[model samples]
Target chain A: MDSLDIVFTGFLISALRSATPLLLTLLGECLGQRTGVINLGAEGQMLVGAMAGYGATAAFGNPWVGLLAGAGAGVALSAVHALLVVGAQANQFASGLAVWMLGFGLSAYFGAALVGQQVTAFDSIDVGAAAQWPVIGSVIAGMTPTVLLALLLVPVIGLWFYRTRTGLRWRAVGESPAAARAAGVSPATVQIQAVLVGGLLSGLGGAALSVDYTRTWAEGMSAGRGLVAVGLVIVARWNPWWTLPAALLFGGAEALSLRLQTADTPISAQLLHILPYLVSLVVLTLTCLRRSDSGTPAGLKAVMDR
Target chain B: MRDLMLSGPGRVVGTTLAVLMLTGAFFLAIGRDPVELMGLIVRSAAGDGYAITESLVRATPILLCALATALPARLGLITVGAEGQLYFGALLGTGFVLANLGATSAAPYMAMIVVAMLAGAAWALLPAVLRSHLGVNETISTLLVNYVAALLVTWVVYGPWKSAANLGWPATADFPEAFKPSTFFDSRVHSGLWIAIGLAVLLHWTFVRTRWGLTLDVLRSNPRAGIAAGLNWRRNVLLTMALGGMLAGLAGILETASIQGRLQANLSAGAGLSGFLVAWLARNHCLRIIPMSLLVGALLASGDGLQMFANVPSSIALVVQGLLFVAVLLVGGYANRLQVRRG
Candidate 1:
C-alpha cells in the first residue's frame, strides 16, 4: 500500500479499536435508559471492571476468567444502583453519582497493585494472506476478539430490541412502566434485568480498555467514556440500533484526534485531546434541538418531569 | 412504636453514626486496625494548628464550591460543573494578571478577581443556556465542559502562557506580588477563608431576604406552582447557574491568588466532586453548607493521611463518601414519603 493509504487504513483500524469500549458502554447505557433507570455510574463500573479484569488476569493468568470477573464486578456495582434506585426509590442521579465515586475509590484502592503491571491482552486474529486484500483487509486483519464481538453485538442488540417479544416488553417498560404493569409485564423485573445486563456490558467495556486495548490498568482509565456513552444514548434517541453509528462517530473522532497529534497540527495537543468530548457536546446539542420522530420514552419523561 | 423520633436532625445524626460504624467495619474487612486509623484521621485533620490551617485552606474552596452547587440545585438544576468553572476562574485570573505584568497593584487584583468570577459564570452559563433554552441535561453537559476546561488549562499553561521561569515544567507565569491575597494569623491561613465565609453568610442572607431568594424557595418546593404563578423560570435557571458558577470560579481564583499563585496542571484536584458531595449532604441548604464544607474538607484531608498511617490508598475516602451518599439518599426517601403523607 502507498504511505497515504497505509496511514488512512491504520487510522481506520485504530478508530475501530478505540470505539470498541464506547460501543459496549453505549449499548449498556441505552438498555438502562430504555428501562427508565438512568445510570451515570458507567465510568465507575468501567473503572472497577478494568481493575477486576486486570487483577484477575494477573492472579489467574487467564484473560477470559479475568474478563468474567470484570463483568461480575460491574454487576456488583450496578446491583447497588438497582437496590438504591429501584428498591428504595432514591434519586437516580445522586445514586449514579455515588456509584461513580464508589467505583473511583474501589478501583483506586483495589487496583493499586495492578498499576504499572501489564496483562496478557487480546492478540489480533490471523487471517494470513486473505488479510492482505486492500481496503476490506485492513478492517478484518489483526482485529481483536473484543472488536469482533462489538461488531457482532450491533446486529444482535438490534435484533434483541426489535425482533424479540421480550424486547417489546422492554420498550413498554421504558415508555410507560405503569402501562407495562397493567399489561401484566413487571416493570421492576425488566428494569432490574436491563440495569444488570447493562452493567455487565459496561464492565466488559472496561475490560476492553485494560485487557484488550491498553493492556494495562490505570486509575480513572475509563476517562469519561461512560459519560460519553450516556450522551450518545440521547443522540441515538434511545434506540439500540442507533448506538452503532453514534459510537463509531465518536470512535472516528477519537482516531482523528490521535492522528492529529502525529500529523503536526497547529492546534495545541491539549486542545486536540478534547476533540472527542467537544464532538459529543455538539452531537448531543443537535440531537436534542432537532424535533424528531417519537417523543422521549414515557418513563424517562416521568422521571425528568419530577 | 409508641415513641416518635424527631425528624431531620435525628436522621442526620443516625446516618452519621451509621456511616462511622460502617467505615469502621470496612477497615476491619480490609484487615486494618480501624481505631488506629480513625484516631489518626481526626488528629491529622485537626489535632494541631498546622493541620487545622491546612484543612481550612482546603475548606475555603470547598465552601465556595458547595455554594456554587447548592444554588443551582435550589432552582431545580444540577450544576456539577464547578470543576470547570474553577479552572476557568483560575485561568482568567492568571491571564489577567499576566496581561498587566508591568502594572502591579491591588486595584488590578480586584479587577482580576471580578474577571475571574465573570469567566466562571460565563462558562457555567454556557451549560445553563442549553438546559434552559433547549431542555438539555445539565448533569452531562456540565461534566463534558469540565474536560474541556481541564484541557484549556493545560493548553494555556503549556502553550501560550508558559513562563520563562518554568524551566520545562508546564506552568503559567507566577502572579505579581501585588495581587496575592494577604495571609491571616501569620501562617499558611489566607484571607480567602474569610471570603469563603463571607460568601456563605451572604448566600444564607439572600436565601432568606431577597425576592429572587423567595422565588428560588418557591421554585424548589413547588416548581409547578411557581410556574403557574407566572414566575420566569428560564431567567431564574440562568441566574442560579451563573451565580453558582461565579462562586465556584471565585473559589478557583482564591486558590490561584493564595495557594498556587500560578496556573498548573493539577488545578482542580477533586474539589468539584467534593463540593457536590458537600452540597448534597447539606441538603442544598444555605445555612448547612458552611459546616458541611468543613466536615467534608476534613474528611478529604484525613484521606490524604490514610496512606501515611496505614499504607492504604487515600482513595478509601472516596469509597466511604460513596457509601455515605447512598445511605443518605436511602434515608432521604423516607423523609420525602413522610412529607407527602402529611400533606
Candidate 2:
C-alpha cells in the first residue's frame, strides 16, 4: 500500500478505537433517556467505573473481572441517583450533579494510590486470515472484544427498542408516566431499570477507557466524554441506530487531532484538541434548532419545558 | 412533627448532624480517626486569624461564582457554565495585561477587569441565546461550552501567551506588581472579598426590594402571567445570564490577579463547581449564599492541613463536600415530601 493509504487505514482504526467508549456511554444514556430519565451523571459514573476497573484489574489480574467491577461501581453510583430522582422526587439535574461530585471525589480518593500503576489490559483480537486482507482486514484486526461487543450491542438495542413489548413499555414510560401508570406499566420500575442499565453501559464505557483504550489510570481521565455522550444522544435524536455515526464523528475528530500532532501542520495541537468538544457543541446546537423538539420524549419535555 | 422537622433551625441542625456522621463514617472507612480529623478540619479552616483569612481567600472566588449561579437560577435557569465564564474572563483580563505590559497605572488594572467581565458575559450569551431563541437546554449547552472555554485558555497559555521566563511552564507572565490587587491583613485575602460581599448585599436588596425582583418571581412562577403583565421572559433570561456571567468573570480575573499572579490552565481549580454546590445548598438565596460559600470554602481550605497533619490525601475534603451535598439533598427532599403530604 502507498504511504497515503497506510495513513488513512491507521486513522480509521484509531477512530474506531477512540469511538468505542463513547459508543458504549451513548448507548447507555440513550436507553435511560428513553425511559424519561435524563441522567446528567454519566461523567461521574464513568469516572468511578474507570478508577474501580483499573483498581480491580491490578488486584485480580483479569480484564473481564475489571469490567465487572467497573459496571458494579457505576450501578452503585446510579443507585444514589435513582433514590433521589425516582424515590425521593428530587430534581433530576440537581441529583445528577450531586452524583457527579460524589463520583469525582470518591474516585479521586480511592484511585489516588492506584495512579501510575500498570495492569494487564485487553488486547486487540487477531482475526486470522481476514487480518491480511486490505483496509477492512486491518480494521477487523484492531477490534478488541470490548469494541466488537459495543458495536454488536448497537443493533441489539435498536431491535429491542422497536421490535419488542418491553421496548414499547419503556417508550411508553418516556412519553407519559401518567398514561403508562394507567395502562398498568409502572413508570417508576421502568425508570429505575433503565437508569441501572444506563449506569451499566456507562461503567462498561469507563472500563473500556482504562482497560482497553488508554490502559492507564489518571484523575478525571474520562475528561468530558461522558458529557459528550449526553450531547451525542440529543444529536442522534434518541435513536439507538444513529448513535454509531454520532460517536464516530466525535471519535474521528479525536483521531484526527492526535494524528495532526505528529504530522506537519500549522494548527496548534491544543487547538486541534478542542475539535471534538467544539464539534459536539455546534452539532448539538444545530440539531436543537432544526428539530425544535420533534422527537423529544414528552416526559423529558415536561422536565425541561420550564 | 413534620412542621418541626421541616422548620428552618431543624433543617439546619439535621443537615449538619448528618454531614458530620457521614464524614465520620468515611474517615473510619479510610482507617482514620473520625473525631480527631473532624476537629482538625474545623480548626485548620478557621482556628486562628491566619486560618480565617486563608478561608476567606478561598471563599472569594466561590462567593462570586455562587452569586453567578444564583442569579441565573432566580429566573429558573440551571447553568454549569460559570467555570467557562471564569476562564474566559481571566483570558481576556490577561490579554489586557499582556498588551499593556509596561503600564503601571491603576486605570489599566480597572480596565482589565472590565474587559474580563465583558468576555465572560459574551461567553455566557451564546447559551442564553440558544436557550431563549431555540429552546435549547441551558444546562447541557453551558456544560459543553465550558469544555471549549477551558480549552481556549489552555491553548493561549501553552501557545501565544506562554511565559519564556518560567522556562517551559505553561503560564503567562506574572502580573506587574502594580497590577496585583491589594491584599488584606498580610494575608492572601484581597479586595475581591469586599466586592463579593457587597454584591451579595446588593443582590439581596434587589431581589427583595426592587421591581426586577418581583418581575423575576412572576416570570419564574408563571411565565404566561408574567408575559401578560408585560415582563419579557427572553430579555430577563438574557439579563440574568449575562449578569451572572459577569460576576463569574470578575471571579476569574480576581483569582488570576490576586491569587495566582498569572493565567494558567486549571486555574479555577473546581471553584466553579464548588460555587454551584454552595449556591444549591443555599437554595439560590443571594444572602444565604454568603455563609454557605464561607462554610464550603472552609471545608476545602482544610484539605491542605489535613494532608500535612494527618498524612491523608487532601482529596478527602472533596469527599466530605460531596457528603455534605448528599446530606442536604436527603434532608431537603424528605422535608419537601412531608410538607406536600401535610398540605
Candidate 3:
C-alpha cells in the first residue's frame, strides 16, 4: 500500500477506536444525566473499569469475563453514586468529584502492576456486501463488532427511553421527583436503575478501550476520555442517539491530531495533540449557545444548578 | 466549634473504621497483609523527621489550593481548574522573571513569584466571568479549560521557551537559586508551608469575622434568600471565585519557584485537584483544612513508598483514592439525608 493509503486507513481505524471509548461513556452519562444525576465520576469509573477489565481478562483469559468484570466494577461504583446522590441527597457535584479522585488514584495504583500486560481482543466482523461499496466499505472495513452493537443499542435505548411506558416513567421521574412521586413512581428506584445501567455502559466503554483500541492495559490509559464523554453527553443534551455523532466528531479530531503528529509536519506537535480538546471546548461552547430546551433532560437544569 | 468536634468524633471513628475494613478486605483478597502495608505507609510517611518534613512539603501546595477551592465552594462554585490555574501562574511568573531579570537575582525572583500569583488569578477569571455572565456551568467549563491551559503551557515551553540544551523533555530553564523558597529547619520543607498555614488562618478569620464572609455563607445556603435579603450574590460569587483563583495561582507560583523550579509540563503534583478534594473533605471549614491537608499528604507520601518497600506499583495510591472518594461520597450522601431528617 502507498503511504497515503496507509495514513488514510490508520486514521480511519484510529477514529473508530478512539470514538468507541467516548461513545460508550457518553451514552452511559446520557442515561445518568437523563435521570437527573450528573456522574462526574465517569472519568474515575472508566479508569477503574479499564483496570478491572484488563486484570480480569489477563487473569481469566476470557475477554467476555473481562468485559463483565469491567461492567460490574462500573455498576458497583455507580451504585455508590446512586446511594449518595439519590438515597442520601449528597451534593452530586461533590460526590462525582470524589469518585473521580478515588477512581484516578486507584486506577493509577492498580494499573502500575497491570502495565505491559496484553489481552486477547475480539475480532472484527466485516460486512462483505457493505465492503463492496466504495465509500461505505472504507468505513466498515475494520469496524469493531462492539461499535455496531453500540449503534444498535442507541436506537433501542432511544425508543425505550422516549416511547415506552417505563421510559415515560423514567423521564417523568427525571423531570420532577415530586411529580413523579405523586404519580406513584419511585424516583429513587428509577434513578438507581438508571445509574446502574449507566455504570454498566461506562464499564463496557472502558473495556472497549483496552480490548479494541490499544489491546493492552496501560496506567492512566483512560486519560481524559471519560471527561470528554461527559462533555459529549452535555452537547448531545442527554439524547442517547446524538452521542454517536458527538463522540465521532470528537474522536475524529483526536485521530486527525495523531495522524498529523506521525506525518512529521511542521505544525507544533503539541498544538495538534491539543486539537481535540480545543474542538471539545468549541463544540461545547457552541452547543451551549443553541438555547434549545429540547436538548436538556426535563429535571436536569435544576439538578445541575444545585 | 468544640461541640461540632465532640459530636462528630463518633462519625469520624465510624468512617475511619469503614475505610480500614474495606481496605483490609481488598488487601486480603489480593493476598497482601493490610497491617504490613499500613506499617510500611506509616514508616515511609512519618517514621523519621525527614519523612515527616517531606510530607509537609508535599502538603504545602495542596493546603493553599484547598483554601483557593474552599472560598468559592462556600458559594457553591466548583473549580476543577486549579491544576490549570497553577500552570498558568507558573508560566506567567516565569515569564515575568525572564522579562525583568537580566541576571539571577533575589529581587527578580520575588517579582516572579508575585507575577505568578497574579497570572493564576487572571487565568481563573475567565471561567468565573463565563459562569457569572454567560450562565455557563463553572464545573465543566473549568474542567475543559484545564486541558486548554495544560496545552497552552506546553506550547509556550516547547515552542518559544524550549531549553535548547535539553532533549526529550518539555521544560523551561530552571529558576535561579535565589528564587527558591527558604528551607525550614534544614529540611526540604520551604517557606511555602508558612504561606499555606497563614492563608488557612487568614481565611478562617475572614469567614468568621468579615461581613463579606457572612454574606457568602448566606449565599451558599440559599441564593434566592440572599437575593431577597439584598445580598449582592453575583458580585460575591465573582469575587470569591477570583480570590479562590488567586490562591490557586499562588500555589502554581510556589510549585514553579520552590519545588520544580521550572515550567514543567503538568508542573503540579496533582495538588490543584487534590486541593479541591481536601477542601471538600474539610466541609469548607477553613479551620479544619490544616489537618485535612496533612492527612491527604500522608496518604500521598505512603503511596510514593509503595515502590520501595512492597515493590508494589504506585498506582495503588490512585486506586485507594478512587475507593476513598467513592466511599466518602456514599457516606456523605447518607450523612446529608440524616441531616435533612433531623432538621
Model 3, span A1-306: residue lDDT tens: 457765676677778778887888888899888878888888878877888988998888887787788888888777767877887677777778777777776667667778888787776685878866654466677687767767777888888888999998888887888999999999989998988888898888887788667778876678677877777787887888888889988889988988878888888777787777778877877777676677677778886666
Chain B of candidate 2 achieves a TM-score of 0.98
Worst 10 residues of 3 chain A by lDDT: A131-140
**Candidate 2 chain B: minimum summed lDDT over ten consecutive residues — where?**
B1-10
Mind giving the per-residue lDDT tens digits that candidate 1 earns over A1-306?
A: 788887877888888999998899889999899889889888889998989998998888888888898889999999878887887687888888888888898999999888888677655578788787887687788588889888889889989898999999999999888889999999989998998988899998898888888888888988889988988898998888888889988889988988888889898788888899999999999987885637478788666546
- Model 1 docking tier (incorrect/acceptable/medium/high): medium
Model 1, B1-343: lDDT tens digits are 1012237776687677767787888789889788887788788788788778878887888888989999999887877899999999998878888889876667898998899999999999989999989878899899889888988999998899998798999898887788889998777678888888888888889888999889998987898899999998889999999999898899898898788888898677778988898899888887788888898787777777667866768888777877787777766765565566667
Can you write out model 2's per-residue Cα lDDT over B1-343, one digit (the tens) per residue? 6777889888888888888888888889888899898899998899899889989999989999999999989888988999999999999999999999898878998999899999999999999999999888899888888888899999999999999998999999999987788998789999999999999999999999999999998898898999997889999889999999999999999999999999999989888889999999999998999999999999999898878887878888888888898888887888888889988
TM-score of 2: 0.97
Chain A only: TM-score per candidate: 0.95, 0.96, 0.92
* lDDT score, candidate 1: 0.85
lDDT score for candidate 2 against the true structure? 0.90
